[model samples]
Target: MEIKTKKFKRDLLNWYKNNKRDYSWRETNDPWKILLLETISQQTQLDRADTYFKLFIKEFPNPETMASSSLKKVLILWSGLGYNNRAKRLYESSKILCETGFDELYPNFEVLPGVGPYTNNAILSFAYHKKVITRDVNVDRVFSRYFGVDEVKTFIHNNKKTLLDRVSSRDLNQAIMDFGSMVCKSKNPLCSSCVLENNCKKYIVKIKRPQEAFSGSNRELRGDLLKLLLSNNKLSLKKIEKALAVDREKLLKATTTLEKDGLITIKKNNLVEINS
Candidate 1:
């Protein structure tokens, strides 16, 4: 299916003008805040991401404050967010930004810890308002469905100039993300109401995958362990195992993984604590 690039862009931007999501992150062009929001939103729901973003921006406000603080402090605020490594990376990246400066890091954001291609482009589009497309799952779904192609990167590369011409990258990216989430959702998409319905090539309902059970999962165990350590300064291995009601081996494996992720420290004295 050949997409009318100009018409598609017009329809997309027009739909966005009426239906775009109003996020606090969208209100500013501050690169630091944008980076923080992008990092927090990764693999996290928008609502929960916003909650954490508020907490983080309130406490840190800027890279300098976060860089000056200890990792343990950041982890405490980031406790319930899961994927605790994100907080650590944010802390590490903040230090780098503080030392090297944001301007110097322009277009090379991947050098920062945990900032991948999507995030790097996201920062450029959202913060710098550069002509770059962020191909996250949401953006990918929208484009893939519209073009009836799995190779979204190739499609974007071919149509980059036309898609972004005379359009604000920030608005265009945010519009696509919002449209995907609201209209072209993975399950139960509202195709009848979608503005691009007529032009959509593969307007089919996506199969929803069953969510993994969180109960009895390693993820739950890891969260429990972190909660325990967050309340106390440190805990003995035996104490953690007993408290979590897990076997010694399971506890050790979880701790090893967490320690490897730089989220916690297993001291020589058989004590575990959030990494400093």
Candidate 2:
């Protein structure tokens, strides 16, 4: 079943017109500050991200100011978010932007690490009027349900312009993300009330809870392995397998998946470390 992206975009925005959250950043167009929210939000709830975003802007409000602040201060502000490296990346990206001699300004939505298509589009659409597609986990899950494309990464990787051109990037990007986060949930989504239900492939698939198996499945297992790997630099696969105490085969599968995801890399004698 083919879903009309424009129609889906319209429905999402109309729903958003009536039901969007009044976030503080929605009213601002400062690219540097927007980038701050985008980075500090790494795997965290929005309310918490809101608090952190406010704290960060208060400490360093502009690119020139943030470029001067030590990364240690940024990491300290970013504590409890679990991914300290994103903090480092955010700081580094700012410094690079400053040193680019681009008038000590944040670049125009290009030339940013960790600021991929999604983050870039988010800033561009919200901060500027440029139409761009922004896909995060919520949008990815919703799109998968709408189109039944399990390999969403590949589809997104190949069809960037087509998708971005179809949506009202300035409004629809945030709306789609908000719609999915609030309505098109990962587990037992409120499909009945979902505006896109009529066009959703999940309705066609008739799958009650598509993301259920994914929760306790290999993904979570790999994340647990990652927490351990990040804390302790290296360990043999056999040692990790034994420590987890499930089965060597399962441990190998999880470790292999993590490695393939570029979250970890093997060293001498099955030692593993987080990618820098």
User: What lDDT tens digits, residue by residue, belong to model 1 across residues 35-130?
Assistant: 899898987889889999999999999999999999889988988888788888999999999889778999899999999999889888877889
Query: Between which residue pairs do clashes occur in model 1?
Result: none
The residue ranges of model 2 lying beyond 4 angstroms of the native Cα positions read: 1-3, 101-110, 150-167, 203-276
Candidate 1 Cα errors over 4 Å, as ranges: 1-3, 203-212
Q: Write the per-residue lDDT of candidate 2 for residues 1-276, one digit (tens) a residue.
A: 124765666677789999987778877777777789888876777888998998889988877777798755665566566555577678778788676732333334557667776677777767776765677878878778887888778866666565666555657677877787798876668988877888878833334444446455676667567666655767788778777666877777877776665557877777766664
For candidate 2, which ten residues in a row score worst on lDDT?
101-110
* Backbone clash pairs in model 1 (N, Cα, C under 3 Å; residues 3+ apart or in different chains), count: 0
What C-alpha lDDT does candidate 1 achieve relative to the native structure? 0.86
